[model samples]
Target: MKRILLACSSGMSTSLLVTKMQAYARSIGDEAEIWAVGQDKAKEGLKSADVVLIGPQMSFLKEELQKEAEPLQITVDVIDMMAYGMADGKRAYEQALSLMENK
Candidate 1:
């Protein structure tokens, strides 16, 4: 199973997105472990993730997060603002899968 970690300024909003991602994954029969954490816990979350997606509000941390993730052979990306704002989990989930595939 793929482990996808999502980080945002606070865990609350991302928790909603996690639910959507989970629903989308189930709909397509994609097995994945999806979770969300506040930016403060992002590093800890990264330890177990196959990929990391930072919420738009936290996008500025992408470079720093990527540096931490690279050595662990994890792909890191910023979730698209439009998709995130609209709570489009399918798009976000697809984005994560695409990043994993290209890696």
Candidate 2:
């Protein structure tokens, strides 16, 4: 199963998106362990996550977060604004997978 750690400034929006990702995972028979949290909580969750996705609203932190995420060796990306605003789960999972593959 793939594990995805999604983060936003306060986790409020990403929390909603987590449901979408979960539903998508189910619909496509994807075995995924996905969760959402605010930026501060990502590192703890990252220990077990296969990938990490950040919200575009928090794009400023991407560089610092990348530094922190390096040791874990998990792929990290900023979720597309359109996809995130729409809460498209399948797109999110695919995005995560693409990052993982490239990493």
Candidate 3:
């Protein structure tokens, strides 16, 4: 199963997005482990993540996070602002899948 990690300033808003992404994954019969964590805990989560998506609020950390993830062969990206604000799970899931596919 693919492991997708979403990181935000506090993990609260991303938690809601996680639910939507999880539902979208289930609807399509995609076997993925999706979860959210605060930026402070992202490093620990990155150890097991296949893809790392930073929330728009934390997008500033993308470069740093990518550096940490690269050695692990993990794809890292910042969630699109509109998609994240609207809680568009399908889009978020697709974005994650696309990154992984291209990697």
**Whole-model lDDT per candidate:** 0.91, 0.86, 0.93
Q: Write the residue-wise lDDT of candidate 1 on 31-89 in tens digits.
A: 99999999999988999999999998898899999999999999989998877888888
Choose 2 or 3, whichever is better by TM-score: 3
Q: Number of the top candidate by TM-score?
A: 3
For model 2, residues 40-91, the per-residue Cα lDDT tens digits are 8876777878888999988887787788779878767899888898998888
- The alpha-carbon deviation from the true structure for residue 40 of candidate 3, after best TM-score superposition, in angstroms, is 0.4
- The deviation in Å at residue 28 for candidate 2 is 1.1
**Candidate 3: tens digits of C-alpha lDDT, residues 9-77:** 999998888999999999999999999999999988999999999999887899999999999999889
Model 3 spans > 4 angstroms off: none
Candidate 2 lDDT: 0.86
Considering TM-score, which of the candidate structures 1 and 3 is the better prediction for this target?
3
> Which residue pairs come into collision in candidate 3?
none
Error of model 2, residue 48, in angstroms: 1.6
Q: Please give the lDDT score at residue 91 for candidate 2.
A: 89
Cα lDDT, model 3, residue 12: 95
lDDT of 1 at 100: 92
